[model samples]
Target: PRFKSKKATRQGFKTDRAKIIKGKLRLDKPHGIKNWYDIRMSGDKLLTGELKVVSICRENGKYWASLPFEIEVANKAKTNRVTAVDVNVGHINYTEGKINTLPDNLKRSYKRIKHYQRMLARKSVINGKRATKSNNYVKTRAKLQRDYRKVANIQHDIMQKFTTQLVEEYDKIVIEDLQVKQMQMTHVAPKGLQRSMFGYFRQILSYKCDWNGKKLILADKYYPSTQRCSKCGHIKTGADKVGLNGNLKHGTKHNEYICYECGSVMDRDENAVYNLLALIN
Candidate 1:
């Protein structure tokens, strides 16, 4: 066998009888397994309805089970509160006239991850004289993989909390249609900075909003959100002459936006937020 005989990638099994008693998922008389086996249910909500099918699977050195059930949810009451989120390179701009810096837990431990990765790479290759690697090589490789796993876990936890907070508070959420994948490919920004988990954040927002009965909107990519004035119906454009009137202007740091016609200065991201919110209401 290519792999160890005792290990298998996946398995298919089914059971019609299962129940949750005393905060554990119990299965009765599973073939080639113990009778009435139960696993403790922690950090999981008990889905409503009869337990139809339970599929247990393993992924990324972890065990997970998929429980499917049917439930009915009534429509949620509409609210007047609306939120607009504009994603940026360093931070995010949202409605209510506030700016929030994007959170990246992985950045805090990047050096440690790099250290382990370096150790792994240096020990993985066979030397000119040595035909095989030593046990230390395997150990270094495992350490590197574990470090990456830690990063993933941290990212997932942060995104889950942030998305839940948004879903619980706001009924209507609007965000810009950012081209994250394109940004990563172009290498226009720093490699670490561009590889944000914005896609994962949006994916969570989608399903959480649906489950909680909320509305999410993505504005058009080329909507000229930054160029348009939030207060007035004015568009900013390049100057026709050196002393041309109604020429668009911005701060040198690119932190603020200046309207050409209305002559109002505001945070760049905040300006974008207002433009996006104006689309729906």
Candidate 2:
């Protein structure tokens, strides 16, 4: 209530309001809450059933509340459908291994972040022996922070929607448990996009599947999904590819899997999805 008494920057408090009638939230009688919280919420999902906990949080000078609720619902995911997802830099490949590139909106976010970062670096140069943070410096720093936050928010928002669709559409979802950290350290796909997005998608899909009563299976990290043939179960070797420098170039056109058994030459991601799905089948 009294958030500005001290030098407090931000503040938020939660109340266990049992009697939530319509838009008004009422606390227990013992708390002496004469007036109820007139809270209004708008979203695609209609709030129903019982409210578990109401957590109020203040972020970036904004106050928000998270209301976790329980609902009585039927099966959300279609039991007959199953899909394997292949996370990549350019796009997300699902089902038959088709690629969908990143949206222009998300690409713009990255550009803006880089612009703000350059501005922030210029601002940093003003700091010398007698130099302190000027008004312009603080303003520029805040701008950079906002840009970073925008990029993070946009990535999460897109992945959240994508993961939700996957979970709700399919009864079973399978994805590779990628060694992202190791891949990053090893300088794999340095210029490709979505290197940072795989973990985000996986984390969202995992809990969302549990909440919606769907199944999420993680293929082995060492599983040769791309190298194995989906049709005839042929394992392509490095020496098989023509003009390959060393091992087969992963995440590129050269990564194409031409099955020696069935002679099925398909896109690497598409072949991988089929191999991943075969794990559970």
Q: Could you say which candidate leads in TM-score? A: 2
Predicted candidate 2 versus true structure: per-residue lDDT over 1-281, tens digit per residue: 44543344346666666546665554455355576455565665556778876776565545667677788756584667999988777677888445444567657766876886777666667665322257665565566656666767767777787787787778889999998776666555654534347777788889888888899999999888877888888776666642212244433345455666786777777777888999878
| Whole-structure CA lDDT of model 1 | 0.65
TM-score of each: 0.69, 0.72
The numbered model that scores best in lDDT is 2
Candidate 2 collision pairs = none
Model 1, 78-169: lDDT tens digits are: 56578887766645566654433344556655667788676655555535324125666546655665666677776677668767777777
Candidate no. 1 TM-score: 0.69
lDDT (CA) for every model shown? 0.65, 0.69
Q: Which ten residues in a row have the lowest lDDT in candidate 1?
A: 240-249
